[model samples]
Target: MSEATANDFASLDAGQLAALRRRAILSCAIGNFFELFDFTIYGYFAVAITRAFYPSGSMYGTYAAFGAAFLMRPVGAIVLGAYGDRMGRRAALVITIGLMAGATGAVGLIPTYRAIGYWAPILLVLCRLLQGFSTGGEWGGAAAFLVEYAPPGKRGLTGSWQQFSTQIGAVTGSVSAALLASSLSEAAFYAWGWRIPFLCGFLLGPIGYYLRNKVAETPAFERAVETRTVEHAPLRVAMREYGTRMIQAFGLSIIGCIANFIFVVYLVSYAINTMHLPSSAAFSCAVASGLVVVVLTPFVGALTDRVGRRPLILACALLNLVFDYPLFLLAIRGNTFKSLLIALICNAVFQALYTGTIPSILAEMFPTRVRYTALSVSYGFAVVLFGGFAPLISTWLVDVTGNPFAPAFYVMTGGALSAIAIISMKEYRDAPLE
Candidate 1:
C-alpha cells in the first residue's frame, strides 16, 4: 500500500534486495504454512480430538475446548505483538513458531481420557492455549514481515503469500485427513492414526527456525530502529493513538474470520456428523475449497494494487451477503461431495477477495511504530469473538432452532457489518506504510 514504489534498499545492490525478498517471503510463508497446517488438522479432526480427550458423549464440551484456544489469543497478541514492536519482528516470529510447534506436538503425545481420566482433557486445553497464544502473533508478524520486505508498490501480491501459504496448509490438512480416513479403518483412525498429523507439526519448529534465522530483518523494522521510532510501549501507544482504527480493523476482519471457520473448521464436521456423509466427503470439500482460495488469492491481491482494496472487499462482502443462504441450501440439497465442492468454490471466490487484500490493508493501517501490535490485537479480538466460536455456536443454533443452515445467517450479518466498515473507513491501499 505504500505510495513509495521506488526501491529503498538501504544501500544494498538490486540482486541482494531481490534475494532478501525471496527468503523473507519464504520464511514467513512457511511459518504460516505450518501454523495453519496444525490448526486446520485440529479443526478438521475435532471430533476425533474430542473422543480422545473427553468422555464419549461430549460433543458440546469438545467444541467448547476447541473454542477455548481463541480466548488466550488476545493475551498472546498483546504480549508478543509488543515483543515484535519493541524487540523486532524476527524475534516475535521465531518465538511464535517454537511455541506453536511444541504445543501442537505435545497435543498428539498426550494420553487419552481412557488412559488418564480428567487430566487428559485439561492437558489438551493447556496445549491448545499455548498454540492459540503463539498463533495470535503469527499472522500479524508474517504479514508485517512480508509487506515490509516486498518490493515497493508490490505489497499486495507479496502480502498475499500469507493467505496463499495458509491455503497450502489447509490443502495439506484436508488431503491428509481424507487419505487417512479412506485408507485406515475407523478404529485405527480414532486410535493412533489421528496422532500422525499432530506429530508431523513438530517439524515446523526446526524448519521455521532455520528459515527465519537465515533471512535478514525487513527494511521497515530496520528503518524504525535506525530512526529510533520503535515504541517502548506499543500496546499503550496503539490503544491511545489508533483506537478507532483498531475497531475498524476488527469489523473488517469479522466476516473473513467467520467465513474461514465456517468453511475450514465447521463445514466438514457438519457434513460428516449432521448430514451423515462419509468422512471423505467432508475432507474432499475442504480440499476443494482451499485449492480455490489458493488459486484466487494472489490474483485478487494483485488486483487490489490496481483497483484499490475497498472495491475488492466490497464486492466480496456483497457477494457473500447475497449468496450465503443459497450456497448452504445448495450444499444441503445435494449432500454430495460434488455439490459441496461447487458451493465451497463459490464461497472461496468471494472470501478470497477479502483475504487477498487484507494483509496489505492491515499493514497499511497503523504506522510502523505499532503496526504488529495493532494488527495482531485487532485480528485476535475478531477471531476470538467470531471465528473460534463459530463451530460451537453454529452447532448450538442448529440444535436449538432446528435449522441446519442456521450458520448462514451469521455469515450474512457479518457481510453487512463488513460492508459498512469498508464504506466508513479510509482507503489506504495507496498510502505509505510509515
Candidate 2:
C-alpha cells in the first residue's frame, strides 16, 4: 500500500474515536476546573481578604493591591507557555497544577496584617503571582490538549469544555465561600473564614493531577514528535508567522474579558458599594449567573461547529453593545433580587457565545507545533490589557465621570472592538485541528 493509504487506515474507527475524545475532554477539563477554582476563589472572597489585610480607611488601596496581583498574569503566561511549547503539554500541565495548589494552600496559612504587619499584603501578592503563573500556562495547554485529540469536524464541541469548566469552577468557589461565610460571625468571617476556600484547593489538586496523568499524549503531538516537526523556537515562529492572528485574538478577547469583569467582578463591588446590597445576596446572584453560563456554554460550542465562529461572536458583540447600558441601568436602579438575577442571567448567556468557541478558534489559527505558545501568548496579553485592568479602569472611570453609565460606555467600546475583530478573521470552522 502507498504511505498515504496506510496512514489513512491507521485512523481510529467511529466508536474508538468517540471514546478517545471523551477521555481527552474530561481529563483536561478536570485540571482546568481546579485551576479556575483556585484563581477565582480570590474574587469570591475578596471582601473578607481585603478586610483582613488592608485598613477600612482605604478601600481603594485594597482594590489596588488586588489589581497588582492580576498584573502578574501575563508574565506567568509568557514564561510557562514557552515552556509548554518547547518541552511538552503534559509536563507543563503537571507543573501548573502543582504550583496552583501549593500557592493556594499557602495563602490559607499566611499571617494577617495584625500578625505580620506590612508583610501580609506582600505575601498575598507573592501567592497571587504564583497562582497567576499557573493559570497563565494552564488554559492554552489544556485547551490545545483537548482540541489536538478531537475529531476534525467537532473540535469546537470538544474544546468548549475548557470554557464550561471555568464557569463550573466559579460556581464551586462561590458556593463554597457563601457556605463558609454563612457559618461564621462577621468578625470571624473577616478574620479567618476566607482561608477555608483557598485550603480546598489542596484537595482539588490531586484529583486533577490523577485525571490529567491518565490521558495519553494527543495524536497531533505524537505525530509532530515522530516527524520531528516541533519548532526549535516556537515563540519566534509565532511572532513572525502568526502576528496578525495574535492581534485578532487580542481584539476578540476584549469583549470576553470586559464582560467577565463587568458582570462577574465589578458587579459584586457595585452591588456592595453602590446599590447597598448584602454581600450574600450579591454572591448568590453571581452563583446563579455562573450556573447559567455553565449550562449554555456547551450548546454554544456545538452551534459554533455548525455555524462558524464569526457569526456567533459578531452576534454576541453587537447584542452586547445594544444591551449593555440598559442592563446596567436595570441592575443599578432596581436594587432588588429579581432584577439582579435577570440581568445576571442575560449577561452570562450572551457572554457564553464568545467564550465557548474562543479556545477552538484561537487554537485553529496555528499549527500543532506552536499552537500552545501562540494561543497562550495572545490570550495572556489580551487578559492583561483588557481583563486584568478592566475593573480598575471602570471603577476610576465611574468615579471620574460621577456617572454610573461610564462603565456602560466601556463595555460598549469593548463589544464594538470585538465585533470588528470577529468580522475580519477568515472563516476557521473548516480549518484542520492541527
Q: Which sections of candidate 1 miss by over 4 Å?
A: 1-9
Candidate 2: how large is its RMSD? 2.9
Best by TM-score: 1
Report, for every candidate in turn, its global Cα lDDT versus the true structure: 0.86, 0.81
| Model 2, position 184: C-alpha lDDT score | 79
Clashes of 2: 0
Please report how far candidate 1 places residue 42 from its true position, in Å. Answer: 0.3
Which one wins on lDDT? 1
Error of 2 at 350 (Å): 1.0
lDDT of 1 by residue, 400-433 (tens): 9999889999888888988898888999987888
TM-score of each: 0.96, 0.94
